[model samples]
Target: MKKAAIIGGGVIGGGWAARFLLNGWNVSVFDPDPEAERKIGEVLANARAALPALSDIPMPPEGELSFAQSLTEAVEGSDYIQESVSERLELKHRVFAQIQQSCPDTLIGSSTSGFKPSQLQEGAANPAMIFVAHPFNPVYLLPLAEVVPSAASDPEAIERAKEILREIGMFPLHVRKEIDAHIADRFLEAVWREALWLVKDGVATTEEIDEAIRMGFGLRWGQMGLFETYRVAGGEAGMKHFMAQFGPCLSWPWTKLMDVPEFNDELVDLIAGQSDAQSGHHTIRELERIRDGNLIGFLRALKERNWGAGKVLREHDERRRVAFHAAPASGAPLVMAEMQVLPGWIDYNGHMTESRYLFAASETSDAFLRLIGADMDYVAGGFSYYTAETHILHLGEAKLGHRLTGTLQVLAADDKRLHVFIRIQRGAEVVASVEQMLLHVDMQAGKTCPAASSVLDRLMPIAAAHAALPRPDGAGRAVGQRKS
Candidate 1:
């Protein structure tokens, strides 16, 4: 039940708030900006749907939020402190000074992209307590954070920061050496420099460059990094061949890296002006929504491939699995419990394919077994029931997220065999039904076995309850039904 205090409610801070709160960590936010609260609130509204929907793992109830009166009020007794104010050194140093006085031992981090931890800690009484935990734009979704521990900082600070990052589903990389722009942002800087050159020289409009990126390598870059893209270009020869073939291009005049672009108002206005022209169709908020949606889609597809960023997602999913408590099965006969359907369960045709019905029906059967004493642990003791065969009759199509419940009945059961009739319910109507024949097998001899004495005791009640319930709709007629 550790609490996290956020001192700035800007983009990064708002995302941090969403992440912590979603992971069941109490969050206290303090933002003096007149519009910070409103902006963060809008971000949280999108985050509420996006974050939980990101995983199949049943997340715990999100932690409550408290809008603090002041910075001190937010940090009091907070286990972790995140300072995401403006990127100016003076402003960050000021925040650090207050954080040092208020919570010395608590891990204080700056969400600055370029500033080193040492720079932020400059004017502080206890600068060693502060570090840099630079996160991406949508911190709530993307799970990568760069933890930069200053040379003046304690050795344990990086470890502590990493532990906190892990809890919020972020992979924390502790940079051994500090640099102006750390890791991911370096690539961004390179891209930005080239993009500016394109605009300043009038070779391509801002929208044209954006189109070139979005339609070209930007599409590939979503799932694969730059190195991987080049590796593919090298074909079967790999990086060595790629380097030999294309490394000479660095000397060519392809890029405008010879001269640095000064941060002059005219150039800024030109680029900003074109950007505004290109984006005049939509507001900043709408563009942000579009970007968030793209990020979600990109990251999710990456997770499927289990690539660079997706690997972190896979681990986070594993941790979420360990932390999540699955809903217990309802033992009441013929009751449809959890009928949730994931996107993967549906076919490209937008309906629950026949094979998935078997899988879901099987899961529903598992639920019934769990309710009784014939649970997973019980079956894992070299005595699991094998589904000998299944006969399914799919009456209606089941789309993604369509509530499909199973009303199961022990049509017949004895020591060696189990005959189950499961009706798939969506609201009041029965959408599908299945008859599953399972055999209780002893793995030692690969032969059927009588139910264990302990299992028998639990089975009697379940069988009795299921027997008492009326047969479900779509029950197969005994006369016309095949031997199965």
Candidate 2:
């Protein structure tokens, strides 16, 4: 197992810990604050509830998490180290000094929002190993990580750093030239400055400003981003028309980009009071859950379309799927799919709904079909397996966030027909089981047909292997049948 050292346990550090741990990296955290454990525990709880829902395939087994007493203990022998201490340059340098004392060659990533890579590498024993890996808030959910490297930094180490970030499901934006506040934050600061001016001038309340973004351009930005959204606004003429139409407005007095509101008490109270009036009823954690739920919905919609950040999520799922299927089939039932009970999968009774149980079974069976070369490519060639009948038994409850394993056992198989038993399990317990009969069909003819040789060649062996196993009790049972 790979090891990661998190040299802080505040919000970002805890998020880093959660992301690495969920991706199956053993993480050791070092934070001097007394409440770090409690704080990180809460973050982990929230991460556990949200992260798995973003994935269609099962996640890797969670890695072990440990809290180290000293920074040296945490960094020792770690493959990667992320420092998320307070945004004080001196404190970061101190932390870096201590970290290098133990593992000088290990890559040390700083969660600094404003510091350039050169700034971070100052006074370092091994400057090449240190770089800016700034992540947005809720590092476990958002995928973007600004990976800034200086001229002094090693190219090989930077590339390796990016791969590590990708392994934990992050999109590493390599900033070729480092600048103050990096990329996303600079845009955010502009919007924030304008938002502050709006409130100060009594133009809009906090709730109104939030509604403007969440209900308007925020949606566009989430999908197509800034330039593409404007390109669409350009219509047939594209970016040229867009610039010709709005280029002169750059000199207009619409935004106070170069100006700043005085950071005085009155301004703080105005924003804080409006924010409190807007959302003070819910705690911070409650707000985080609400935000995460909304993000999941938006991201899942994008994933369905394979656009924007959703594309990153889909690619990560595909990577995991490849790894999950890498092992050769054992003699037992093939574990075809791994999934989690997402928030939407549950009903009012707080258990996984009936339709989702079938969905899970379909996911499992679809995986098995793909294993036998009857995937989308095969279907696109005017042939595919169509489910003819299905029977599902609800053996137990699967609640939200429960990890599920879908296993398939071939009961029978022939050129044109397949009979299979599938189990949806939560750990060792079978929460549900599905028995299905499928027929291979030629799509153009609308009639059952024999499967292609390539598919049957793979399927027949698995069928022969499973034929020796005892028949599942749930198989061949009619509805309302008594247990025998």
Candidate 3:
């Protein structure tokens, strides 16, 4: 297992820890704060409830998480290190010094939103390994990580860093040139300044400003982003037309873009008072959960269309699926799919819904079919396995957040027919079992036909191996039959 060291355990640090841990990387966190463990634990809880829902395939088994007593202890033998300490440059430089003392060559990433890569590299023993990997809040859910490397940085190391970020389900935006606050935050600082000015001028309340964004342009920005959204706004004329129409507004003083509001207590009280009235009912953790859920919904919608960040998610799932199948099969029944009972998979009584059990079985069988070369590509070629009959028996209960595994045992196989038994289990106890009979069919002819030799070559061996094992107890059970 790959190991990562997190230098701080604040919100962003905890988030980075959760992201790495969930992606199957062992993480060591070193934070001087007394409550860091509790805080990070809470963050991990929220991540457990939220992150798996965004994935269709099962996530890798969570990696080992450890709290280190010292910075050197955390960085030792770590494959990656992320520093999310206070934004003070001296503090960051000191942290880097301490980190280099232990793991001098490990890629060190600073979660500094405003500092340029060059600024971070100053006074470093090895500057090239230290780059900015600024991530948004709730890092486990948000995929964007701005990777800013300076001219002195090693190009190969930066590429490796981006690959590591991608392996953990992040979109590493390589900012070719490092600037203050990187890319996203620069736009954010502009909007933030405008919002502060609006509040200071008494033009809009906090709630109204939030509504304007979330109800309007915020939704647009979530998917298409600024340029693409405006390009669409340009209609047939495109971005050039958009510039011709709205470009003149750049000169017009419609609002204050370059003005600084007084940083007095009065302005602070005004913004704080309105924000309290807006959403102060929920605690910070509660607000985080709400934000995460909303993001998941928006992202899932995009995923269904395979557009925007959803494409990233889909690609991540496909990568995991490929890795999951690449393992060599053994003589035992194949472990086909690993899944978690997501929030949507539960019903009123808190048990996994009936449909999901079948869905789980399908996930298992589909994987097995893919293993035997009957995947979507093969189906597109006008020949595929079609389930002729299925008998399901629910033996136990699976609840929300429960991890389930789908294992398949092939009972019989021929050129045109396959008989199999699948068990969906929560660890050792089987919660459900499905027995299916499938026939190879030619899609154009819509009739049963022999499977390809390539597929049969893969299937028959597994079938023969499984045939040597004892038949499952419920292999041929009839529906509603009395226990005998």
Candidate 4:
């Protein structure tokens, strides 16, 4: 089983643990926080549902998780270690010092959004082993994680960390230099400082500024980053023209990056009070759920386009292909009466999920039916077929994360009914089979009826074409035998 260790059981640490665990890595957490167990438990519950929902690709069974008694126990024999303690330099240094002694072989990483490996690893025993693996909040939902390494870090360390991050749905950008805030955070800090100044000087309320960003370009920023957005703004004139148009504004005294804003008590409350009014209704978990939903939708949209951030989505698609155990649907034909369990359709017993078995059988029959022209639009009008009864025999366990293929052939069909058999196979082995009896129904009226003349005419030819295929061994299986 894959395994990793997480230090500091805070929000970031819990996020890291959740990401790894959902992707089938056993994670041990070494946080001394009194509430760490409760917090991590909450994170994992959301994680289990969130992670699987993000991908249709079958995620392997998740590994075991344990909270460690000490830092050394967490790191012992682990493949990777993420240090997400508080943001203090001394605290991180102390943690790193302990981590180095405990697990020298483990690649040490920090979840520091505003600090570099050089700063975090200032006096560490093996600074090369330490690097920055900055993950955004809700790490499992958002795939972007910047991986920055210090000068002393080894090349192998980078490669190992990259492999682990990719396994857990993170897109890691390896930065060569160790800047103050790595790469992404610098841009965020610039914006953060300006936002601070806005609140400090009373230019805008927190909610207004937030609305300005969200309703405006921040909405556009998810699919396209700032530069790409500017490129679009450049239009056919291109980047040069776009740069010429807005570049001069850099000199304007609009941002507070260079200017400092004092963080006095009154100023903190002014911003806090504004923010509270803005989002006081929702809890952090509720806000996270909202954010996760939006990010999942955004990522799926990008995945559709196969451009911009969609490139990361495409890479994920490729990874899914590798990790997917399902048999190729188009490349080969399944034999009649043989079982072809689908990866996405099995329960713990390895037998197919009951509804999904019918689903698979129905899917195969639907494909045969569609060649005849009775499809979604045709069904939507007034008439479509419905499975009145289904008989399924699960021969063996179709364990989780296994590939399944289905063979579908029509046995007999007339204007009113379809006689179809579906067999699910795992590799060369037959695992389950379903025989379905479907009735043409007036879907709007919710009752059986004669098939539509237009649809039946088209479907008759294909059903005739497939009818000649000989039935597999279980053709006339008794309903009781199919109950297995």
Candidate 5:
């Protein structure tokens, strides 16, 4: 219902546009580049695919998106304005001036990774409204957004920006003080500098350096981060012990921290060639999709464990669950999950793996629980259902990139038990089916118990609606061929 403006439509700007647009904000974008629309459209396409794919909860219908001819046109009616033009301080100052003139009452944010908030607001008329709200690449997926405000920034404006960001499923890390590169980028620059030294000195190839990251600490960092990870490395002693053990190594000449390698053509060519050799088979778009899929899987995995960013994701999903409005009952099979088979769900046979079929069925169970008033609040109240038994039939094979739908049918239900059937399909073809028997349990008691009346009130209608449907052929079948 609210409107937001994005200035510039490069990678960062387009990403900001996607985040706002997908989160149900009317977005007005201004970029002088001729190809800005097409580029931003492509990013939106990816965002549409990747964002909703992360959860079964129905997202709010996307908001209207339009291109504005000028900065004033974009900013005049916007509630929030994000400036993501080039990194030059002068360019940022010019845009801030325009925004101040057009939308002085609105909260303005910048996507500058390194520039301090003070630098960005130096000459602006309404400097208190402008601050840094830097985000990572593929902004729609990664949740972290550093909210850095200047001394002159309005305290209320900073809090308002953080609130808006959280509403859009972002984790706003408040930077207590404005500094160059903010938080994450400073660490990234340190790593980049060291990596450049490694490549320039021939101590490691570009591919090898990347392998060192992706194959090692990168995975750990994805979940626990630097210090928390090192705490575990300390074994029994934790952070203090680890710090004591590794502190002396800081003085060692293991890294060339004081200087940067010259960026001559030879070094550039060497690094570029190695990078090409490492990943040239796939186009950048292909790589991005792969990266997005991997991130989704990683986040989902962490969500399962309730660790790190996954914990953040779980909190967001809880909010989404509360906001989601299930479709009205129509005696039709309820759509439980609609998603493409992520690359990680495939096996060596190049098709969706058997385990993933079960995963889809599990998702259906979750959706059904939500429908029956057994959502996060219900579960948190110490009552829930647990699967007692499952029977699955592999009807057909589903491959990677296949768009799959899981539809649920409540076969039978009582106060404490539910027998349900789920059909997993690729378009029109039934790829898999699952039959599940679940029992209600009081979590504290750890024993079978009747579910509360509130849950049964919602379940009976679905059971009644599904009572007349023809049974699945494999329903209740044992693992054997029938005799004539």
Candidate 6:
């Protein structure tokens, strides 16, 4: 198994550990704090709950996580070393030196928010092996990891680092040239500065400012960043129109960018008080869960739209689905779709909503399309299967985070029609069943057409294999009360 060594156990380091550990990389951590193990364990628990909710494929079994007594022991055999020590330069230099002494060739990534890679590499034995890998808080869920390499760094090592980060489900943004604060943080710092000024001047309360974001641009920025969101605002005229309309505002006295207020106790207390009034009801852990739940729903929505981070998540899910469930052996189900019930799938009654069952069943039909060569490429070729009718029965309740498996059984098939049955279960119990009738259609003609010979060949074997099995319990049951 691959191994990663983490030299700090603070929030950022713990997040890095969770990302690597959950991705099936063994992790060894070293921190002098007595509570490091307990703290990291808590973070890992949150990660376990949230990360898997974002994808249909389950995460690999977590790798072994152990806390080492010293930094040298952690770095001794690690393939990658991530130093997340305090932001002080001297401490980072000392940690880098210690890492170099133990494993001279291993690439080291510093989780420094402000310092450039060159600054972190100042006193390292091999500057080529050091780079900045800055990740936002809650790293396991958020996909962005800014990878900034200095002039002295090895190009090959940078590429390798990107590969490693991607393997753990991160969108590694390579900073072309080294600069202080990197990209995301620069915009964040400006926003943060403005927010402080607003709070100080009584222009807006902290809650109102937060509401403005979560209710307004935060949703847009989550899927499309500032440029694309503004581009849409430009309408048919496009970005040029947007620039001409808004460019003059750059010189307006609208922002306090040049200076910031002092961090005196009064300012600190006022900000803290307002923030507490805004969100003090929940503990940090509860808030983290809520944030993660919202993020998963938003990302999944974006996946449907095939935009921004959702696109990243969709690609990851496809790769994972292909990896986990390869075209099965001879006797397996004709098609399958796997997923965990997310928070949004639940109703006010605290169980999965009725509409979601139909959605999940439809997913099985989609999987069947992939099985018989009616995928997106094949559909683009002007022929596809369209569902003609669907009948479904809900047998039991599925709560949030319940693991679900839906399997397709082909009951009958003809030249242009397919009769299918679906069974959905959680553990050993059946939760739902669906019956669907699908018709093959020619796109240009918009009429029923026989499936291609290749698809028929694939479908025949599955129909033949399932033909011998005992009929399902709800195979032909009608949706009405029998006379009693």
lDDT to native, each model: 0.78, 0.92, 0.91, 0.75, 0.86, 0.86
Model 3 ranges off by over 4 Å = 338-351, 399-403
| Candidate 3, residue 68: lDDT | 99
lDDT score of model 4?
A: 0.75
Model 6: per-residue Cα lDDT at residue 378 = 86
Which model scores highest in TM-score? 2
Question: Tens-digit lDDT track for model 2 on 186-211?
Answer: 99999999999999999999999999
The Cα RMSD in angstroms, rounded to one decimal, for candidate 4 relative to the true structure is 11.2
TM-score-best of 3 and 6: 3
lDDT of 5 at 16: 88
- Tens digits of per-residue lDDT, candidate 1, 1-484, equal 7899998998899999999998889999999888877888988876765665455343556798988988889999899999888888888877777777778888898889998777777777877778889998888988878888878988887788898899788989888888877788988888888888888888888999999999999888866768999999998999999999999988888876556678799899999899889998898777776776667667767777778777787678667554322333224544423445556678889887778788768767775565454655776787777789877876677787575667678877787788888877776677788888888888777999887877666666667666766665545545355534
lDDT of 4 by residue, 257-351 (tens): 88769879998899999999989999998887667656666766777677665576557645754533233322223332222233445677665
**TM-score for all models, in order of appearance:** 0.74, 0.94, 0.93, 0.70, 0.84, 0.84
lDDT of 6 by residue, 377-400 (tens): 889999999999888887888999
Give the number of the best model, judged by lDDT. 2
TM-score of 4: 0.70
lDDT of 5 by residue, 84-200 (tens): 899899988988887888677799989999899999889789889989999999998899999999899999989999989988888999999888999999898889999999988
Per-residue alpha-carbon lDDT of candidate 3 for residues 409-443, written as tens digits (9 for 90 to 100): 99999999999999999999999999999999999
Give candidate 4's error at residue 214 in angstroms.
1.1
Q: Over 4 Å off in model 6, which ranges? A: 57-64, 233-237, 321-336, 371-373, 387-395, 407-423, 433-484
